[model samples]
Target chain A: MPREVRERQMLDAAVATFARHGYRAASMDGIAELAGVSKPLVYLYLNSKEDLFTACIRREAAALVRAVRHGVDPATPPDRQLWEGLGAFFTHTAEHPDGWAVLHNQARTSGEPFAREVATMRADLVAFVTELIAAAAREAHDDPELGDREVAGLAHALVGAAESLAGWADTDGSVTAKEAASTLMNFAWAGLGNLMEGERWTPR
Target chain B: MPREVRERQMLDAAVATFARHGYRAASMDGIAELAGVSKPLVYLYLNSKEDLFTACIRREAAALVRAVRHGVDPATPPDRQLWEGLGAFFTHTAEHPDGWAVLHNQARTSGEPFAREVATMRADLVAFVTELIAAAAREAHDDPELGDREVAGLAHALVGAAESLAGWADTDGSVTAKEAASTLMNFAWAGLGNLMEGERWTPR
Candidate 1:
């Protein structure tokens, strides 16, 4: 096999193992066996267990970000865009449960460099959501009353909600991607829509 | 001082040190000195570094839950309840940044027992939110249309959003706890209100 193909296979096997057994207990022997390659060859190609895990985080994070970005259409109305974007995100996460587990659960808790890798991906997602919200607000009104800091806060909240819902979907087998997406849409859109129309929820 | 007071002081020091330096890098000597106690006495009371850290997680988690519970009034209408609950949450997190860090950042990534500790607190918070949503939905309609699973999903999303905003508030010093609570209220309540009114955003 070509080196890249072989490396991809290694990463695929590694992500599954890491997702199942977690970082510390996931053995390189299992990963190599799953990849149908010798242990020494696995080490030779990936360098070390840490490097292999890092590779998995990078690949999975890129794939997730790409999936969400591709799922959204820039020209659509903001609500439609958000719906599609969320659909893509939940679908991607549901389909790639192992990868999602690695990125959200394993990589984050494993420590410094790994957590940092996932943080970058999260930051990208937050920024994407921020732009979507800002554009939506601008489209809703001539003046765009939502300030940068408020937009930033909303983005963080939306991303966090999505992240939380994704984890819930993964654990609760009955929740399909569509259902998860709809739940978040029901939980977010009207609030965001109200904000766009300058309808703030004030204390009574 | 009494042993309970001494232990509390040690936990306070440990939480601060852990928050500042993280788990592995946080030193027992620093914690002990900060608590103004001998290192051996600290060990005698907390037993080990792991136990000390665990103690910090438990204490902080309990305190956080208590603050939120105390801040909310059950007799109030649901939106008011959510608003007050969120206010309590953000205020607690901001004022107890070190404790929040221990629960949100440190314990979660540190490993099994620690992560489990934080998870319990999170579960409690999610359940609290779930009840609040369910009650709100019931109050909004003669017969609540929102099902059990949907409420569960929304609770997860709301909790996740609050968690994300708390982290954002910690990082962005200018964001007051009231501002964080208001931002979430604006981001969540209207959407929730729409759902109660049977207005969901369907994909066009």
Candidate 2:
């Protein structure tokens, strides 16, 4: 394989290993072995274990954010947009279970730098949720009752519910993405609207 | 300290240390020193790190279950019962942050036997939510309308929301138990009622 292709293969192997064994437990030799290369060659491509892990975090985080962002269309009804965003999330998590595990489980446990990388991704995702709520509010102008606290709390609940549901859906091998999205919509949108009795949204 | 007092102290220290450092990262030596006991003494009472971790899981899991069970008054309205159950969950997670970390984060990540122990605790909580939904349906008097899959999905969403909120509230460091309870009540009760609309609690 070409160097770039070889490097990508090594990273893929590293992510899968990191996802299963966690950062502390995953060894560089094991990763190199999994990639069908020597440990020195793996180092030549990725430099070190820390660098390799960081690369994995950045790749996975960016992919997840990109997928969710791409899944949404700002022009659509906010409810529909939220559903698409959630669909994107569930799909990414399912398709890249190892990558998702690395980002969610291993990255956090890796401590310090790795934790910060995932934290940034979380904040980004949280902001996306905040915007979705604002859009929903704008689309359904009923009252001035929805305050920052309520919006923030609702966003937290929605995002958290999505994360939790992703893990749950993964465990029950039979569940589909459409089913997961619908469940979250029922659990979130109706309650949010009732709470928002009166809130207006405008362009940023 | 006497052996009984020393044992309790060791267990408390173990729970705190394990909560902070996780099962794999936490050292028995560190726990012993923190408890003001000798290493052999910790070994005397706890036997090994695995047993020590398991003991912590069992104790904290039982405490959490007891808190929720004790918090709800059986005579109250089903809404109130669910409200109280949620309140208990928030309170337990808040007051026992270390134990919460162990049960929610550590044990769940450790895999297999440890995971199963915590899984049992989670199953209890899920069953409680399932039963609560059934009772809500029974009280409402209309046909439940929801299939087993739908109810199970809702239960998972609710449980995940509760767990997520617990972690979020802790991270923010300012949300009190009452505020957390109200946040959840606002987010959940209305959404829950929407499902049971034909039965009892109208969406309005």
Candidate 3:
């Protein structure tokens, strides 16, 4: 097979191995066996264990970003865009459970470099959500703009909630992607709308 | 030293070692050395690496639960209780960063036995939050009760957001426990209160 095809196969095997055995326990030999390639070829292509793990992180993160971006349409209202994006996120994660685990579970727990890679991807997602939230606030003609810190907090909370729900959905097959997306929408969007209107929940 | 004191010391060492080097990489010899105990005594006290890790999980989980429970006064309203509980949580996690990492990051990623222990503690927390959400809904004399699943989703989202913020706060020293608690309260409570009052944010 061609180099590109061989590289893809090696990555697929690496993701599966890393997801199954984790970053430390996973070996190049095991990955090579799973890829149906020689161990030397695995080393030749990926270079080292760290490099292979980084390659897996990059491929999986890009796929997830592409899925969410493709699901969203810039023409739609902010809430609808968020809805579509979340739906796509759940669907992709469900279909690619190992990839999601690699990104969410394995990458974060690995050392600094791998963790940084995942964080960069997460930052991009947070920025995307932040833009949608700002757009919604603008369209509503809200008097006071949410502070940048507050927007960032909301975005992080939103993404964290989505991620938690994705794990829940993955574990319980009965929970559908649409259901997870809608639940988050109800849980989050209403709160954002309330915040924009200057309605706050203070300690009693 | 008394057996109880020595056991506590050993657990502390284990938490530090596990947090730094992860489960697989952390060894009995390392923990024993850190605890200033003999390797045989360490094994005698904790049985095995798995048991030692489990003991750490139980100790940290109980401490966390105690901190949150002690922070909240039952006589106050649900919102106040939640606020106080969150404050305590952030404070405790901030103070015991290694323990928090052991429970939240290392234990969960280690495997089934360790993950289940953490999950049980998490379930207790989720139940606590779910009750608060329910009480808030009842206080408002809402149109209808949130379904069990819906409440569970909100609870998980709330917990996930708190976990994410705890991490962010740990990384950025300027973010105090009080600030983290306040941000989460605003981000979560307003939306929850709105949902109870039959206010909804839908796609436009």
Which of the numbered candidates is closest to the native, going by highest lDDT?
Answer: 1
lDDT of 1 by residue, A86-121 (tens): 999999999999999999999999888999999999
DockQ of 3: 0.55
The sequence of per-residue lDDT tens digits that candidate 3 reaches over residues A1-204 is 899999999999999999988898898989999999999999899899999999999999999989998999999988789889999999999889889999998887675788899989998898988888878777776565677677777787788889888878877788888888888888887777778777777765
Docking level of model 2: acceptable
Local accuracy by lDDT, each model: 0.94, 0.82, 0.86
lDDT of 2 at A125: 91
- Can you tell me which runs of candidate 3 are displaced by over 4 Å? A21-40, A48-50, A110-112, A134-145, B24-40, B73-75, B138-145
Give lDDT tens digits, candidate 2, residues B1-204: 578888889989999999898888899899999999899988888899999999999999999999999998878777788789888999889999999999987887676578899879988888888888777867776566666677777788888778777877888888877677777777777777777774322223
lDDT of 3 by residue, B1-204 (tens): 799999999999999999998898899999999999999999898999999999999999999988988998878887788889899999999999999999888888776678899989988988888887777777777565677688777888888888888877777778788878877787777777778777766677
TM-score of chain A of each: 0.98, 0.90, 0.94
Worst 10 residues of 1 chain B by lDDT: B195-204
**List of clashing residue pairs for candidate 1:** A191-B191
Instruction: List candidate 2 segments past 4 Å from native.
Output: A20-30, A33-36, A109-113, A138-143, A198-204, B1-4, B21-30, B109-113, B198-204
TM-score of candidate 1 restricted to chain B?
0.98
- Chain B alone, candidate 3, TM-score of 0.95
Q: What is the lDDT of residue B190 in candidate 2?
A: 78
Fnat of candidates, each listed: 0.92, 0.47, 0.59
